[model samples]
Target: MNARVLVAYGTKNGSTAEIADVIADALKEAGLRSETRPAAAARDVTEYDAVVLGGALYAGRWHRDAVRFARRHEHSLAERPVWLFSSGPLDASAGERDIPPVPSAARAATLLDAREHVTFGGRLEEGARGFIARMIVKQGRGGDFRDMERIRAWARGIAKEISKAGPASPT
Candidate 1:
C-alpha cells in the first residue's frame, strides 16, 4: 500500500498541466500512488492522503479554476498535507519582477496550511498567444523560462515527505 497523492492543475496554454504530469510521474517513481488531473476534474481531496495543487499565473493571479478548487475543498485540504505551486512570469530572474500568486490564492494556501507554495518560471507560446499575449510577445517579452530540474527537485522533495509517512489507507 502507498499513499495516494493528487496532483491537480489549471492551465491556460497547457504549461501547468505538463508540469503536473511531471510531478505525478516523479511521485510514482518515488513509490507513491499519484494521479494528475485538471482542477475541474478534481472535485474532492478527501480521497487522497496528500495533495499537490498547481496553476498558471495570470496577471499575478492563479488560474480561476485552481482558486475555485481550493475554495471548494478547503476543509478536506486543511486536514491533509498540501502543497501549492504556480507557473508564470517569463522573467528569468528569480527575485524582483517575479509575478506572484494573487492574494486570494495565498489566503487559500494559508487556510489549507499548505506545506509550501512554489512559484516556477513559465512559458508563453506564440501559437497559443491571444491578442494581448501576442502584443506582449511582439514587444519581446516572451520566452520559455521553465526550469525542469527545479520542478523535478520540488516533486522529489514532496515524494520524500510522503514516503516518510509510509503507506496510507486509501479513502
Candidate 2:
C-alpha cells in the first residue's frame, strides 16, 4: 500500500514509543509508508492516510498526551481510518486483554469508526518509576512482556486495512 501511516504514541518511560517504532517498521515492511512520533510532538494528522494511536496505561488511565491528541484531532481523525492500542499489562501470563486504561479516550475510535482497538503487553524496567509506580515494581511485577511478533501482526493487519481501502487522498 502506498498510504502514509502514522504510528503516534504517548509513553511514560519510553516503552510505548519503542513499541510504536516496531509497529512503524512492520508497516513499512508491509509496503506502507509509515512514521513514528510522540503524540505530544506530532504536528497534525492531516497529512496521513491512516493513523495508529497508542499509549501507555497507568493507574487505569492512558497517557494524557495520547488522550489530548485524540481529542484535539477528533474531527480530522474521524474522517480517516484509525486504530487504537494500549500497552500496560506487565504480566502477559495474566491473560489481560481488553484492559484499556482509558476507555473514554477510546471514543476517538468510535468517532472515527476505527478498525480495531488492541491491548498489548508492556515493560517495566528495573529503575523506571514515578512515585507510586516504584511500589508496584517492588511487588515483582516488572519485566518486559512486549511481544514483538504480536505487535508486527497487528501492524500487518493495519496494512491490510489500508490496502483494502486503497490510498487515501489528503484532506
Q: What is the C-alpha lDDT of each candidate?
A: 0.84, 0.84
- Candidate 1, 22-114: lDDT as tens digits: 899988988889999899889777889999999888777889889888988987887778999998878875334444457866886888889
Question: What lDDT tens digits, residue by residue, belong to model 2 across residues 11-126?
Answer: 99889999999999999998999999999999889989989999888887888888888888888887788898888888884244565436755665676677788888889877
Candidate 2, which segments miss by more than 4 Å at Cα?
93-101
How many residue pairs clash in each candidate at the backbone level?
0, 0
Cα RMSD of all models vs. native, in order, equals: 2.4, 1.8
Runs with alpha carbons beyond 4 Å of true place in candidate 1: 95-100, 167-171
* Pairs in steric clash, model 1: none
Worst 10 residues of 2 by lDDT: 93-102
